[model samples]
Target chain A: MIEIEHVSKNFGKKIVLKDVNATVRAGEIFAIIGPSGSGKSTLLRMINLLETPDGGHITLDGTDIRAGPGLTLDIRRKMAMVFQKPAAFDENVYDNIAIGLRMRHVPETEIKKKISDVLEVIGLSGYEKQRAKTLSGGEMQRVALARAMATDPAVLLMDEPTANLDPVATGAIEELVLRINREFGQTVVISTHDMLQGQRLAHRIGVLMNGIFSQVGTPREVFALPKNKDVARFVGIENIFSGRIARISGGVAEIESDGTVINAVTPLPAGTSVCACIKPEDITLHLVDGSQTSARNVLDGRVARMTAFGSVTRLVVECGIPFSVLITWKSAEEMGIAEGKPVKISFKASAVHVVEDTEVRRP
Target chain B: MGYIIDGLREAFHLIVSLDPDVMEITALSLVVSLTATCVATAIALPVGTAVKFTDFPGKKVLINLIQTLYSLPTVIVGLLVFLLITRHGSLGFTGLLFTPQAMILAQTILILPIMTGLTISALSGVDETIRDTIVSLGATRLQFLTSIVREARFAIFAAVAVGFGRAISEVGAAILVGGNIAHRTRVLTTAISLNTSQWEIGTSIALGILLLAIALVVNTGVSLFQQR
Candidate 1:
């Protein structure tokens, strides 16, 4: 387990991270997800001790890694880092994977056995004599992974390991990461800008924004109940309306935004200013009245725009305000959905996530 | 024109026949220069690696200074070694003046700067991420240094070759410090100088051809080694 306590870093006058804190549990994948330039790489580097924190200390298990003047080599040996760029020594694949073991003074025969095993694990068998420098980017990255795994580290730190790879290559590397974690029970801390990847791989995710973790939870919690508007937007929530609660009745609140009242289930009191958030997939579209759908909030609107993304088509419907709706391409085609087509959109009252609007308007 | 043609013909004949005097001078030149280059590489590589990894107050200026010495004049080095190893000088007790050892010492000093500077550049050419990766792999300090040096091996090899080229081709240092003593300290360059001055143009041309051939062989050897 690794614990980051109030860690901060700055380069010159630029504050890259500030008072960042998160704990990575043992034998579980912890992902740090953020937009570019949000200090995700810096945070991972700090955990690997490649970059020292400016204001905080990190601990491995219970020992403060930076406590003593010269930290023991055993502590560092327990962890290995895979960089954003694929790096290999100017040598053959066998030597590249054997380097870490040789550094630990493993015997030649044992080193050979470890190299073969790691190569098999990374699915690069029969590549021992290949020149690592001549391999493809994805192959070289796999070799880098093999190199790290040969040491049998307790913690594997990966910083956007597949960012430079193509989609097919990215999937292969992601699968390898998952397999290694599950099979070896190595604690994995990976950082990525792709939120979907975080959702797919991490047991828990930390949403880093503005140099700090804004939200930390499971994939379901983070995607469904984001702590603020920034996290909701980052997590791909497209429908958010700023409003003030007008009244509450029977554990539900009616919020008014631009003369459009939306009913949602919330414990916040009446007359509170808030923003109502809804996931695009949660809204159901109907060609006729959606009153039969048993949903609390129903809005009649015309499709303002339509955009197709692979198998799913997104429709931006303008009711009182614009609402983004995601529906299957087949459903959209069956309904003949197009721009300027009138549609009724309905969602359950419980689907609307409400949070206090803390946005400061700049004139 | 006829005399020049005759000299060329005789030079080719001497080379083909492998004249003992020419062969002996050629062998001595190889022995002296190769020895000096090996010794210089032994000293310069570690010094250059040290200068590269250590950060000091005047590191940039120090690197610039080493680079500037890459073009240091051979006569200056020859003169400096002469002053130190002459009859009454500081190192005179060792009696190294005007010997093959003095010539080797002069050539080593002549090429040390260039080799050291080139070695630093070679190490610099390695990617910055490689350094981080090595450290993250739990390498000890010694292991880290050796690994980085091994990564930059080809470039360092080129540095050593350049040092050998400079050492072998230098004339002023060989003549000044070695005195060009025949059958003793006379090498290809100094022998060529002596034969040219005495109007033995054929012998000088033969020695010059042999010198160029040696350089070509060494360069080819280094390149082939790098290719593997």
Candidate 2:
């Protein structure tokens, strides 16, 4: 397990991370998701002691790495990191992977076997003699991954491994990540800005925002129950509205935004300004006036727009406050949902998670 | 004007027939310059690698200073060596003023800065990712540097060649500290300077040809290595 305690870092007056803490257990795939420049890379670097923290300590399996022992190489070799860029050495695939094993003094036959095995795992077998620089970006990143896993470290840290890859390549890498985690049972911590990728790959997820982990839990917990408005925004909550609480009773509050009143379950005092977050997938749209369901909030409005979004269609309905709903195109055609058509959008009161804006606003 | 062609003809004659006098001077020059370059590289490589891999206050200023010294005038270096080994000067007890040792010392000093500056540039030009990947791959500090040396081997070999070229072609320092003594401390550069001053045009041109041949060999090797 890796323990990060009160880790803080800064460059000049710009704070990259502040008082961040998290524990990554062994054999679990952990994903850290955040916006760009949100200290995701910095936190991964701190774990390997590549960048020392400004304030706190990180312990690996019980050893305080920052202490004065100087077995830093042994500690570093215990884990491996793959950078966003394809950082292969100026050599062929065989030599590039062999270097890490050689550093550990692995025997020659074992090193050759390990290189071939890692290449097979990365699906680039028989490319031993190819110069790594001549390969394409996706291929080179795979070679870099093979090199990282060649030594079989106890923990694997990858920073945005599939940031700009095509979908086919992204799917390949995600499958590889799952295989490594399941087969080797080596702890994995991957940093990504894609929430869907985080949800798909991570056993546990950490929402890193403004140098702080605002929430850490399973993917379902983070996606459905974000702790703050900022975390919700980062985790793809498109329907966020701000309003003052108008009525509060029995653990529910009615908030008014853009002349639309919304009822959310929260214990906040009435008249306090708060933001309501609702997932786009949570709001269901129907073409009829059938509001006879268990839902507590329903609005009647004209369909503002509908567009095909990959596997799902994104439909927006305007009822004073526009709400975005994601449904399959099959349902869109069956219900005859289209632009300028009157439709009804409904979601449960429990689906509306409320959060106060604690971050300072820029003028 | 006719003497230019005649000098070239005589140079070929001396080189082809391997005249004993010219051959001895050629052999001594090769030995001295080769020793000085090899020794300087042994000293400079580590210094350059240290500067590349470690952080220190005023490191940039120091690097710039070393670069400026790369074009330092050889006569000033000769004068410094002269003062150091003169009879009235500091280390005159061993009588190394006008010997092959003094010439080697001067040539070593002349090429040290070149070797160090070019080495730093070569190693620094290596991809920054190499360091990060090596360390993350579990390399100790020493192992990390060994990996860098192997990665930057081509550029480093070029730097050594450039240093050797500079050392072998230098005349000012060699002349002042070696006194151009025949069959003793005379090298190609110093002997060429002497023959040129005395209007021994044929002999000087012959020595110049030899010096150019040595430099060509170094540069040819450099270009071929860089192509890899």
Candidate 3:
């Protein structure tokens, strides 16, 4: 396991990372999700000692990376990092992939065997003699990945490795990430600006923003329920309506807005201004039939817009306030959902989450 | 037009016949310049790469000054060497003045900046990404630098070609230090100048053709490498 504690970094009087902590278990894929300039890359670089942390220490399996007893190479050799932009050696492809193994003084026969194997794994089998400098951007990136795995590092760190790639290339890299993890059992730490990608690939995800981690959990928890307004909005929570707490009874709080009433399971007191959060996926659409169930909250609205997000479909409903619902394509097809269609959407009062209006959590 | 045609005819004949005087001059030119190029390369590459990559106060100005030396006049270099090698000058007891040794000294000094300056420029063209890749590959410092040298191979090749071109074609410096002595210190450039002064157009034109051919061959080789 790799444990990072209270790490901080600064660049020219600017706080780039503050009090950051992460725990990555062995053989698991961990992702740090953040926007641009959110210090995610800095944290990864510090783990490899490429950038020294200003305040805290990171340890891998009980050895501190900053400890003076061992050469950083001994630590670095166990961890491989693939950069955002691929940098290949000026030699041929064969020699490029052989570099890490050669550094360890691996036997020539073993180096050749390993390089040939990785070249095939990266889908560049026939390119052994081709010049690395002549490869295309995606091909060179694959070679960079191959070189990183040549020595079979115990941990792999990636910083926006697919940020510059086309979708086809991105798909291949995504598959490669899972394959390498399942096959080699290496711990992987990746940072990306794409939340959906982080959700898809990682076992656990951390949301990094403004030099602090606001939330870290399984993708389902972080996506289904955000702890605060900033995270809720940043994570693509579609409906965050301003409301005032009305009254509290039996672990449920009534929230009154401009033209609608809602209830949430919160401990906020009456007369306090708060924001009510709801995920689009949590808003389920019904046929507006007379039949009803135990769901506490329900409303009728005309579909304002319909759009497809890959396999999932999203629709905006013109209730008193606009509410968005994300549903499976099959469900949308069966319900005949389209723009301007009147439909009923409902969610339990427990689905609503409330947070104080004046709170800003920063680490 | 007739005069030019006849000169060309005689130049071709002299080249074909392999005239001993022309051969000696051409051989000496290659030997002296190639020696200087080799010696200059041994010093310039390490020095240039070090001075370029090392961070120190006034580094940019230092690089600018070294590049400025690329324009230093060859005659000024000859004058410096002439003073040092001339009789009654400092360390003049060895009598290298008016010898091939003096000519070689002048040429080495003349091309040092060309080699060093162009080397610095070539290495600076290496993307910052290359350094990060090598260092992250678990390479020792020596391995990192050696790999970079390989990456900058073409640029260094061009620098060597340019340096050798300058050395082989320099007339003023070679004449000043070697005194254009016949069959001994005479090179292609100095011999052409001497023969032209004596109204020996055939010999002068033939030597000029040979020099032009050598430059063409060197440049073509470098071009092939670049294209490849």
Best by lDDT: 1
| Two-chain DockQ for model 1 | 0.73
Candidate 3 wrong stretches, greater than 4 Å: A256-260, A267-273, A284-295, A299-320, A325-345, A355-363
Between prediction 1 and prediction 2, the one with superior lDDT is 1
The predicted structure with the larger TM-score, 1 or 2, is 1
* Candidate 3 C-alpha lDDT tens digits along A1-363: 899999999998999998898899999999999888999989988887788889988999899988883668888888888989866877899998887787788999999889889988888998999999899778888898899988788889998889988888888888888888888897899999999899889999999987888888999888877767777787788889878889887878888876777778887888888889987877889876746857777888889999998789988898888898998999989988888888988888988988787663334
* Rank list by lDDT: 1, 2, 3
**TM-score for predicted model 2 compared with the true structure:** 0.87
Task: Return whichever of 2 and 3 wins on DockQ.
Answer: 2
Sort order, DockQ high to low: 1, 2, 3
lDDT for each residue of candidate 2 in B74-119, tens digit (9 for 90 to 100):
9989999999999988988869999999988988999998899988
The TM-score of the first chain in every model comes to: 0.96, 0.92, 0.87
Model 1 lDDT at residue B63: 90
Q: Which ten-residue region of model 2 chain A has the weakest summed lDDT?
A: A354-363
Q: By summed lDDT, which 10 consecutive residues of candidate 1 chain A come out lowest?
A: A354-363
lDDT of 1 at B41: 95
Q: Using DockQ, give the best candidate's number.
A: 1
Candidate 1 residues lying further than 4 Å off, grouped into runs, are A258-260, A287-293, A340-343, B1-7
Residue A259, candidate 1: C-alpha displacement in angstroms: 5.0
